[model samples]
Target: MTGNPAPAAAYKGPLPRATPETQPFWDGAKAHKLMLPWCEDCGQAHFYPRALCPHCHSVRLAWRQASGRGKVHTFVINHKAARGFEDKVPYVIAVIELEEGPRMMSNLVMDETPTPENVHVEMPVAVVFDDVTPEVTLPKFRPVR
Candidate 1:
């Protein structure tokens, strides 16, 4: 989980469909960076970018780089793989609490099989990028080395 992830094959699962509001986040991931929408007025950050700030309801939102360090807030092991993910059964779907304070739903890539005995709440993790396609790269999390 701490080392470079095995290069993933072209992503077969649902790819992110970036809209005008979320282009920046997608672009950052393409460049192997983690970016989140930040609200200047509220001095807060948010995910799943939107036109209005969720904190202060301000339109003055901007993209900011994230530290990419967080703890696993919660997680579940998916034994049933959704289409295109059959090759990757028993994956971990986790809610990660970013250091910037926003929680995001993402797949947790680990070197070991994720189990209740190993994947625990509040486990420290860091971001990893998978270039699933030429136009899209996904940000996933892994245990910090």
Candidate 2:
């Protein structure tokens, strides 16, 4: 299947639960924007939003708009299906190193069949949003053409 898969009715897969620290990130995704928590003290960006900066251990954090551009740091092709991913076997799960300097794990959606030849380390990618539900949107990546 090319591009993003069609949204299923009553999505049976896992969904992210927004916490107080992560609400902004989810809000940004819902708006089709990639936002990251930036440490005001060390000027570093981080994912999996938390109360303190992972780099400098500072409480001074702010939300910043990310370029949504990154490179595949590493990845794996999943042959075994997860709870809601049976139809999507052989999909790629990648750790994307964002240009802003933090790495995040997300699904790498491809326009073609996923394989070792199609996906590799250092592959350039960009973010795409999947509105699985009215309340939740997922940030996935696609190869940058």
Candidate 3:
């Protein structure tokens, strides 16, 4: 099968309320790119779209395109999901350690059933864009071929 699955139903998930600081990030996602905040002072990358660098507390922040390659640092098999996720039972919620040295929390999309036996720590993953809506395309991770 192609890497993409059936289209999701109109993004029932809670859409991000984009502020000025986070609008660029959402815009990048809509374009199927991972844009991260980089600090000019310390020359490091960070997540969560903050104005200040978490490492050096510097206001010199810039947006850069990420490689979209990371490993599953940690994850949980969520047996129960919230409103928009009820249809996807037993899904994975994982923290990925991007090659750029920043960790981002996102969903894990597997080819087959996701079990503890198949999903492991530090498993290599790649980004796949799921266009939940016309304006929002989420970046989910899947095992690398």
Candidate 4:
């Protein structure tokens, strides 16, 4: 409820596996930077880093730092807990529409307990990094207060 969530001692949640395409993203997250893949051909940014641009299918892609600002396009209040998330029941899973024009799914961290009234569509948010492990830092979001 303060800022970024505290790192779990033994984080049971599924960790992200960084492949060649996503290594830069993971690295940037570790450094508290939100990096996005930009298509050199179309000059558009994209998420879920890939070798080829989803917009133009061009392999001419480059990594660039993002604004780390976005809005909650849509979200779900998960009353049910998935594996490794039992302690975080009633959490928020949101689709954030980044200012760069790409939407990405990530956990919406709240300064208060997550609830329907606490989160809403088009809510302004900024990226926060959850250092889940020494080697992995997951990018999450919190209300831009």
Model 1 / residue 94 / CA error / Å: 0.3
Lowest lDDT sum, 10 consecutive residues, model 3, at: 1-10
State the C-alpha lDDT per candidate.
Answer: 0.87, 0.89, 0.87, 0.90
- For residues 10-120, could you state the per-residue lDDT of candidate 3 as single tens digits? 457787678988889889988889999999999999988997898999999999999999999999999888788777888999999999999999988887878999999
TM-score of each: 0.92, 0.93, 0.92, 0.93
Candidate 3 pairs with clashing backbones: none
Give per-residue CA lDDT, model 2, range 5-88, as digits (tens): 466685777998989999999999999999999999999888889999989999999998999999999999999988988877
Question: What stretches of model 2 exceed 4 Å from their correct place?
Answer: 1-10
When summed lDDT is taken over every stretch of 10 residues in candidate 4, the lowest stretch is 1-10
Q: How do the candidates rank by lDDT, highest first?
A: 4, 2, 1, 3
Query: In every candidate, how many clashes are there?
Result: 0, 0, 0, 0
Task: Write one digit per residue (lDDT tens) for candidate 4, span 1-145.
Answer: 2354556676889988899999999999999899999999999999899999988899999899999999999999998998999988889999999999999999988757888888999999999888888888888998996
**Candidate 4 CA-lDDT value:** 0.90
Q: Which ten residues in a row have the lowest lDDT in candidate 2?
A: 1-10
lDDT of 2: 0.89
Q: In model 3, what lDDT does residue 127 have? A: 84
Query: Which model is ahead, 1 or 2, in terms of TM-score?
Result: 2
Per-residue lDDT of model 1, residues 36-76, tens digit only: 99998999999878998988899999899999999999999
